[model samples]
Target: MVSENETIRRHEQDAFDSTHSQEERNEHGQFATPYDLARAMAEDLQSRVPSDSHVLEPSCGTGSFISALSALSDSFTITGVEKDSSLSETAQRLWANDSCNIVNADFFDYASSESEQFDAIISNPPYSRHHHLSQSEKRFYSQLAVSFSGVSLSGLAGLHAYFLLVGTGMLKTGGIGSWLIPSELFSVNYGEPIRKFLTQKVTLERIHFFDPENLQFDDALVTSCVTVIKREKPGDGARAVFTYGDFRSPRKTISIPLRELAALPKWQHLENYEERENHSGRVLGDYFKAKRGIATGGNSFFIKTRDEWHNEGIADEWLSPILPAPRSFHLSEVTSDASGWPQESDIALLNIPRTASYANLPTPVRKYLDGCPEKIRGSYILRHRSPWYSIGNTKSAPIVCTYMSRSDSTPFRFIRNKSDATITNAYLGLYPQTSMSEEELDSMCNMLNNIPSDVLINGGREYGGGLKKLEPRELMSLPLTSSPS
Candidate 1:
């Protein structure tokens, strides 16, 4: 008879070949965790799991966690279940030295049937969104959440959340789990349920947020975090650790009392160390409407210098005094003319059309546009229908934020809007309405401008050439000075 290990290995290879064509893996965000990260997460869990514990690694991609567990402790019994047969097989081969119970099965399906509870559950679950799942599958996952957390999680919650919810359920009381997931859950609105579950149902022991500048996954661009939690809530006054910076080399560690964590509405704000001061009345949100910058489908095609506009025979009306990407706009305060145009500026602007418009431009411009490949045009600033120009008027806002920035030398930077030429979508335009007093708007602007660059970069997603993009929702989540209505 074939050995159990060899059987598992064969199944894993066969399943991998059958289930995932290379393209499918890429589409599904199925990049396996690097050994280093997996090892670190496993070690982090081992520090919490008691000796002789039963550990479960749900959604074990190729058994990185299993390998880490085996290396960390031979005494701890391990059970690894992988959705992909080929990966499960590979994991079986990798852990043949140890007698791990390896199963090739879908975690979402198998987890519900598990009769035994584990002392620790660990995984780097797939990040695929619910849309990828069938309606029946989504309902199954949603029902699973109800079974696990008592509270229902939206199907919109990413697969990772399901793993956490289901994995937590499979854990014995006092069981601990460590997960490698996108740091976005801490701040995103959709993650509110997960956070609530963590704080109330289980003990959220610690979260180690990685620096956004040094992306952890080669295949994925998102900044990630390792969340360690226990199945049971700790007693009163218990504190949970919140570590930030490089996980490999942490720079800061904070121990926040569970009560305090539970009190806070949003966990992302915790990273900023927000302190609530005694207040008498209203908040900034009460007085002024906070709005992020407009998003031009494409920036390079729209934002251009006057000289470039004139030289290219593009109308001045088609161009605007848009802020350069974060790196180019260095100054905080900008002086503008009586009409709000920049008094003196070094940057130049040029007109380019949206994807469809490119083919219809004049010969010279068309030739220039044609020289650029479709791949380049499809990116954020290039995909618009009329790429050569944008629509925002020159009525400048009192405050502006760099839509994209970096952390090379300067810590955080914001440029004041002083020109009549309004910025394109690459900026957060803060326009104060007539209802709000100038002082109140200025105060709010000052508060926004003061946000640290590191925080800004971390909150936003990065693009080509280290460029970062912040959606309106992401920017709105930043801790701003608020007064009651």
Candidate 2:
């Protein structure tokens, strides 16, 4: 009973999905674009280019963009470069028209050898995380940025950021380029190079950020934005349009000066309804220092519950009270026993002091450690330390906030740690600055806990799955609504 279009769509998805595992697709950051979005991008590109212009899709997947472009115009010769041979071949078969050309090649490699520039380069580049890349790959790309544009990119820059540079390199003089990229580039440290290139190198035309609550890709967790740039010199007083909501028809728009864009640390604020007036009032950073919670190289092996430690006959002296996972800790305040252990949480972190002699250790503790996995000893964090098991010195903070949250989930929990407890990377520890009192901190915690949802939305960056996360610096930069007296 399925319609022809429905049957065709189902077949296309089955063919694409059968070629690679989800892990492989994630490694390559390949998420198929929806037809509507691809069409929107094609229409935008078509509006700018001449009828006979040469257009390129650098990371075309299954030819969604190609089909859209073809539907828009038969005048332009559309060329697509896709890394996956199966998808490239599929695209060629589906769009068998002579106007379309699908090249099965790696975009980065192809871009390097390509001497001719295209009139328009439109793509949704791979969103692979930098951590997924090897050290050699990182070094090569880091150096590539410097050699290509004289801009030194952060080592943590993602695959999509590098694609922007490549797209820039492939752009003809005054040619247009548009990319559908994760919205994280607005504020993440790694996005600085791309932001610099956009402001200093290209004439940034418009940035359309889709609504965070209404995700574009059902399978992907990332919120996305469309970035439009032209390889033309920016003029004095030039400004870029910042649009929010749907990519095609935005709910709201703001015009930001190019100079302002260059100076601002976070572009998320541009989506705000109206800029807050300048104020010199003390911020969270003024009264407290925020640092991410401990990153134990191997959490499963290093972090254990009290039950597990007791079963192994480990002594309390060698362990530190650690907060339970953020989702498990519901209350805003944590009370402790006389031993300084969180009364409500049973989780404890395994700690080994550097000065302590393992030779003098209790037999039970030594035996337990001997049974530990060899992988833990070779872990990145442990391998670098003198003693493999030592977690280093971490003092309990007066307040802690979970670094990430789901939009519909409870607001980011700020816990008053009234115990000698440490937390994992899931939380950020907040220590009072010099001269700040515990009572003042208590008030600040309460105020921060009551932060308006709108404020949080504007301050934090949304990841895939509508998960909102804040870095220590971003959380600290947030302007306090009221001073804690």
User: Which one is best on lDDT?
Assistant: 2
- Backbone Cα, N, C clashes tallied per candidate: 28, 3
Per-residue CA lDDT of model 1 for 265-309, tens digit only, reads: 555435556444343343333433446554655455545666766
Best candidate (score: TM-score)? 2
Looking at candidate 1, what is the lDDT of residue 68?
72
Candidate 2 off by > 4 Å: 1-10, 94-99, 131-150, 273-281, 297-315, 337-339, 373-384, 408-410
lDDT per model vs. reference: 0.67, 0.81
Q: In candidate 2, what are the lDDT values of residues 254-368, reduced to their tens digit?
A: 9988988898777764766456555456678887899888988888887888889988898787899988888777788988999999998888888988888889888888998
Q: What is the lDDT, from 0 to 100, of the residue 432 in candidate 2?
A: 81
The estimated TM-scores of all candidates read: 0.73, 0.88
Residue 171, model 2: lDDT of 78
